[model samples]
Target: MDEKKAAILGEIPRLRRYARSLLRDRDSADDLVQDCLERALVRLDNWQTGESPRRWLFTIMHHLFIDQMRKVNRRGEAAMLPLEASEAQAAPAEQVESIASREIIDALQAMSPDRRAALVMVAIEGFSYAEAATILGVPAGTLMSRIARGRDELRGLLDDAARRRAIRIVEK
Candidate 1:
């Protein structure tokens, strides 16, 4: 039990980071991480030794994140904050170009939850296609389609967002 607890403790940061990226809100991410850890701890007796704890934790986080996304979607309200404000308190960037590129985060928030999760798994979390497919519980071909469509949707959404921003600036 102690060994299992130690193992879970070690993976908390990575799990939290993935959740934060998916949820896009600091408070909700932390809550999700805590819930995941508690669930894992309770189920630790069933966890097989020699298996990757990180992967197990990630699987739990993935399900929890998906469940939360569903609930949020049912509420018919957006969970994402404005992209610029979200980045303002992040780690300082040494280059102005880095700051300019931060608008992509906002664009990501505008995406559908399925696309956002798929894109984050591949593009942000650096998971391979197979790993992401398994994590997302989709067939490889379906995963590919989701990712391709996700990219196209993100591009369109971001372009629209940027255009709106530009128009607002011009109007001002």
Candidate 2:
């Protein structure tokens, strides 16, 4: 049992990185990792020997991430993100990049959780559609459509933001 747990521990960093990219915040990623570890530990008896431990841990993490996404979608951004003011005050960066990242995050938050998950898995994580579909528990065609929609929506938001910036410059 100790050996099994030790082996599972080795995959935590990759899981954390994947969760961080999916969640886009440090604390949330940590929480996801903790949850994934707990779940994996509790379910260790079910894990078959010689199967990919990394993939198994990732599957658990991905499911937890999906659940977190659904909860946020239900509650909306304002309800989920109470640290925004503090974060904004502390952020030191070129104004344009900050504004763009904010717009992108906002656009991502507006997307359906399923679509957002698909985007993260396919685009950000560089997972193949088949692998993403397996993680998402959806058909590959469905995953592709969700990715397409997510990309289109993100592009629209970015384009609108650019246009607004251009308009402001013109007015000045």
In TM-score terms, which candidate is top? 1
Runs of candidate 1 exceeding 4 Å displacement: 78-102
Candidate 1's residue-wise lDDT over 6-54, tens digit each?
Answer: 9889988888778866765567789999989988888887788887787
Model 1 clashing residue pairs (backbone): none
Q: Cα deviation in Å at residue 171, candidate 2? A: 6.0
Q: For model 1, what is the alpha-carbon lDDT of residue 150?
A: 88
lDDT for each residue of candidate 2 in 86-128, tens digit (9 for 90 to 100):
2444433443346667657656655666787789776766778
Report the number of clashing residue pairs per model: 0, 0
Q: In model 2, what are the clashing residue pairs, if there are any?
A: none
